[model samples]
Target: MTGAESWAREQGDAYISLVSRRAGEFYRALANEDAATFFKKPL
Candidate 1:
């Protein structure tokens, strides 16, 4: 899959890049969370 960094560098869109990157990091962090915590919030 194309990453935010790739698109950021290619298109030079800093804002979208930041958002995409943070979204990725957020999801990655979420993956490591326990089921109880994971289900704490809605998707």
Candidate 2:
């Protein structure tokens, strides 16, 4: 994670990843915040 973040910084890009709903709390506990929320609709 550290290496990836560093590389992203060098390239002037944001480091992001997707976490499963079950693991959301785990990542949040690490001080990572959600950049956005996704929604789905079924026709």
Candidate 3:
């Protein structure tokens, strides 16, 4: 791919990773009954 396309793909991957992290945190928080702490981190 072109340089610009590569950069876009990288950004997409980063976003997907972030979303996945957030979802995992949210799920864990629900399981543990600590929603406040889950929203406090990088996710």
Candidate 4:
């Protein structure tokens, strides 16, 4: 993978670790997720 992709993967791991059912940061983190990944449908 490219450097950016690798970096994102690493960051994703960190995010997954930080995710919690008790906290609402998961939604905020998901909101910050790259739009390209969030919206992959063809327009």
Model 3 C-alpha lDDT versus the unseen true structure: 0.46
Q: Which stretches of candidate 3 lie over 4 Å from their true place?
A: 13-43
Please provide, for model 1 over 1-43, each residue's C-alpha lDDT reduced to its tens digit, 9 standing for 90 to 100. 2575577779876533122423556755644322232224667
lDDT of 1 at 20: 41
Give the alpha carbon lDDT tens digit for every residue of 1-43 in model 2.
6787788899999666775668788888877788777788998
Clashes of 1: 0
Worst 10 residues of 1 by lDDT: 30-39
In model 2, the clashing pairs are none
Residue 40's C-alpha lDDT in candidate 3? 52
The TM-scores of all predictions, comma-separated, are: 0.24, 0.53, 0.26, 0.27
Given candidate 4, what's the lDDT at residue 18? 32
Full candidate order by TM-score, most accurate first: 2, 4, 3, 1
Candidate maximizing TM-score: 2
Q: Report every candidate's CA lDDT.
A: 0.46, 0.78, 0.46, 0.46
Segments in model 4 whose C-alpha atoms lie over 4 Å from true places: 13-43
lDDT of 3 at 1: 24
**What is the Å distance of residue 11 in model 2 from its true position?**
1.0
Q: Please identify model 2 stretches exceeding 4 Å from their true place.
A: 14-19
lDDT comparing candidate 2 with the true structure: 0.78
